[model samples]
Target: MRSNRFAVMRGTALATGLLIALAGCGGDSDDKGGDSGGQTLKGVTIEVAAVWTGAEGAGFKKVLDAFSKKTGATTRLTPTGDNTATFLQTKIQGGAPPDVAMLPQQGVIAEFAKKGWIKELGPEVQAAAKQNFSKVWQDFGTADGKMYGLYFKAGNKSLVWYRTKAFQDAGVQPPADWAGFVKTVQTLSDAGSTPLAIAGGDGWTLTDWFENVYASQAGVEKYRQLSKHEIKWTDPSVKQALKTLAEIWSKPNYMAGGAAGANSLLMDKAVTDVFGSEPKAAMLSGADVVSANISETKSKVGTDALTFPFPKTGAKPPLVGAGDAAVMLKDNKGSQEFMKFLATPEAAAAWAKAGGYISPNKALDLSNYPDDVQRASAKAVIDAGDDFLFDMSDLYPAAFGGTKGAGEWKRLQDFLKNPSSVDATAAGLESDATKALKS
Candidate 1:
């Protein structure tokens, strides 16, 4: 079971927004009108809160319904809006927190454990997890020597989504190394296609690139060390990673419209530009972003495009996508049984079928997926071993995460405008990171 300290703190931060939104959504009215007589599953009801909204929320409902049908448990889902961290905090504090919460951000799982709000799932949940999931899933949710959450499904970001036809038209092979990758980009650019579709406007997207490059250049352990502030950003490996990003952004016809204007392109639009028949661009680096975009645009996955792992220097591990885990907050027979259900192969399969993601439970087969790319992505997640986790932004403090969103992306854009600013830019980031850590 994960600890709940972080959830508690996050709840406090999100309390005001949650109250206003809940109040506006007639949540207060529901509280008054609905049976508050403590409805039980069988005779008890379990509340589950998630950040997913719209289609995502609907997809989750399918899985929850399946769980309910099998276990005779009643689940009430509350769409906490876009600010999940805040919404989770609010729900947990009001004495009406969900029994099982789907935490989108994996980095804060440990922090939540440190707080008392979350409870560690004891022997029963662990036994079920051991039977259902791969070792990687178990390792990811284990913190401070205790298991806090059950890994549900994951996506891989170390992928470059490209149009198959576009690559063939340019007469290029998928990049196998950093040099080859750059050459492929140059070839694509020379052929009149934007080499990379960079989305600078959404700051978090930029952070994904940083993590990809960092992991590729220095491997996952070093990347983890960098995140914990154990290694200086001025370290050669760190500088090399940043330089790689700068080079990619600086290339002619590489990033769409150079650095200054690249910020105008959102991730989805950038991806669409690459895969569309008109072929405005050649490739985009992102995780399940392409899948989500294609689903939204009603485009086909394998027919529209495919993805490959980012080329790197060293022995490359499997690329990882973002994933969510179910953390137990209030421990009781009901919560324990619910968590055990979550760690089952049935639950894993249900989640994969509904969400179109790879279940962290290795015992479940992925042959049912329609898209070859998604199946390949699932293989990558399975192969990533214990190194799997989400992007760096979610791993760092909110302030630092925001800085990466706007500050670092902006710095890269500025450097693209003037390559000579590389040293200065790197220095500035290192300084800022140092300060952020100190504070």
Candidate 2:
């Protein structure tokens, strides 16, 4: 069996380093040791591939710099552009794959592991994960009873972003449960504000909405069964979640422009409609990237802009989140050492200090984060402990999870347009999921 080690932690939002930058991993000269923990890792060169770009890429390099110095190693950084899976596959086929790769999806990891293309993490890395991370994260790299990945960096999806001024003006408290959530939207709607900003034009946004609600309402096992196609989409649990979605979606006045204006809003526009001037929508729910959008607006985050966890509506409202998991393709002394470093709080601390990053490693000090928004995102995971689940679309076959027409994207889009036919929507979803997973 092919072995792989997965490591995922939180860092800069939407970091896709489209191009590579050659730079020395920065640090004081004295700390660059020839041997770490009595392991002589002198003069070893490790190759790394990732999609992290912009601030995210820079932050990761800071961590790499630390790893480089600690073990007297150098790294060749390769940016995977938009698709790490495709990039890694091409390299492997050519017998020139990098020593390690930061894979963005569990589905890709599973596929690679099945093809005997990945190497399992070293014992030291696994030990750190057992002690530092929650089980949900530990499982990110594990398949069929063997550990393969480390979920190092995570992004919270359960967060509900809102204009602080709007909530206060309407005398509405951030909701704690699903009932309160619906009621708050009604209150905001009555206050002459768009209660929700939904981006229907972009199909993936619709999938995100459905995943969050479905995971929260249907609970983890059902979510797992559905994600893997073990349970049909037409199951009652899924239907119940769909019906629950309509509770707010069907109420025309509750959405921006009464649902008629959903498609044109787009993701960025949908956010600006809420956080921008004279705000159109009062609330929105999405991953931490929402903060990046908040930064673009004049609203001061944690003040004019704020967030709270998605309301609990199931047996365990595990925080719905997403992250990139680092995995090994080549098992060697150098790559193993780097993986161990990544598993340390000290390593994540470097990225955290760079801002726009969060660490699921409980060993990481929350005070290390630069702002309240990041701390809040990290805290939700800490608060949920081992109860969180990855983004559903990320864990599924692309055919069902992707934005192609007639996939989960279109199904959710259709449901949003005519939410009353949730049964039809659910049936269509099951049919597609079955075909996709089987194929």
Candidate 3:
């Protein structure tokens, strides 16, 4: 049976005066949805922009399809791929922003709002948001006292996935604190197994690792400052966190193929390879979505596999994650209708039923998920509520976060390749942030 074997979850709410006002505005929505004021929305084709591709894209389309069926309106999805900031600027400056953009960050949504390029949620959308989501979930979309985005999909990136039998055989239990975690790593390594499977080659994965550790190690206020470039990366807290990360990185045999081998492993190859039989690694620190991903790579979700929280490495366990948010740019009936639909329990249920989708909306019944494992991950995020932080790198400027070859991704990847270079890495990150956020 799977427990929290290494993961149980619960959450608290973080709300603002504006969101507090929103909280009292409505109640939870029904799973099937409410009236769409259909006459105004019928036959109007709304354009939506998002970064989803492959199965993710396909699953989201089903939700859009459900909206079409409900409101008698057509929806077209425009794939933004990885360049959200540039693509958005190009569209907005050209006077042709999509009716809606499924922004990847609250910070990005705020940026759009600041430039007068997006619309605040209309009354219906705002009311639906209050009815369907938690206050903290709503806060992710709020900036400057206005709600400009509606979170639809989310993931909790704080779990450690392990080869069940390996852990059992090695006499290792999922760890709850840093000391136990290190001991567990040593146990796995001493027992002739690679202790950790790191997705180092994929720069973005490296950033996730840094963010999780930093948030826990350095605290949220510093996390906020570093993310916004309000504080220098060379601060003592940043180095202290790096030292903590170095403990794991410095251990040669703890990871598959030593440091060099781990550095060569790409994100796509990391989990599947690690979870493969005759496994190279006994554990993986990954997001909630990895539950499904491990299965795709032939690892059983709750049997061959199990998970635990990634231990309390600092003041507390911090939930670091990412999500997709719906923001209206056109202010038209179709756009308003679409945003309203996204904030419903029914909209969430549609995607959850389609598989590989998790709604932050508290109104969605856990029964809609694929299985208990999926349910637990969803509940974990819901329970963590207000204490969680968005994926740090994703919450900042492009040059500092999501761009392919630069920013946190590249710098951290470089640091991992040589753990002794933390000082250099910290300096480089600080320099990049200084340049990127110089409005």
lDDT of each: 0.64, 0.74, 0.74
Residue pairs in steric clash, candidate 3?
A: 4-7, 4-8, 6-308, 10-383, 10-384, 11-383, 11-384, 12-386
TM-score of 2: 0.83
Q: Candidate 1 on 309-415: residue-level lDDT in tens?
A: 87775677436456678887778766786787677666666655653456667776877554677777777777666767555655544334433233445555455
**Total residue pair clashes for candidate 3:** 8
Give TM-scores for every candidate, taking all chains together and pairing residue i with residue i: 0.81, 0.83, 0.86
- Go through the candidates in order and give the clash count of each: 21, 25, 8
Candidate 3 worst ten-residue window by lDDT: 1-10
Cα lDDT over the full model 2: 0.74
lDDT: worst 10-residue window of model 2: 1-10
Residues 313-347 of candidate 3: C-alpha lDDT, one tens digit per residue: 78788787778788888988788878878888888
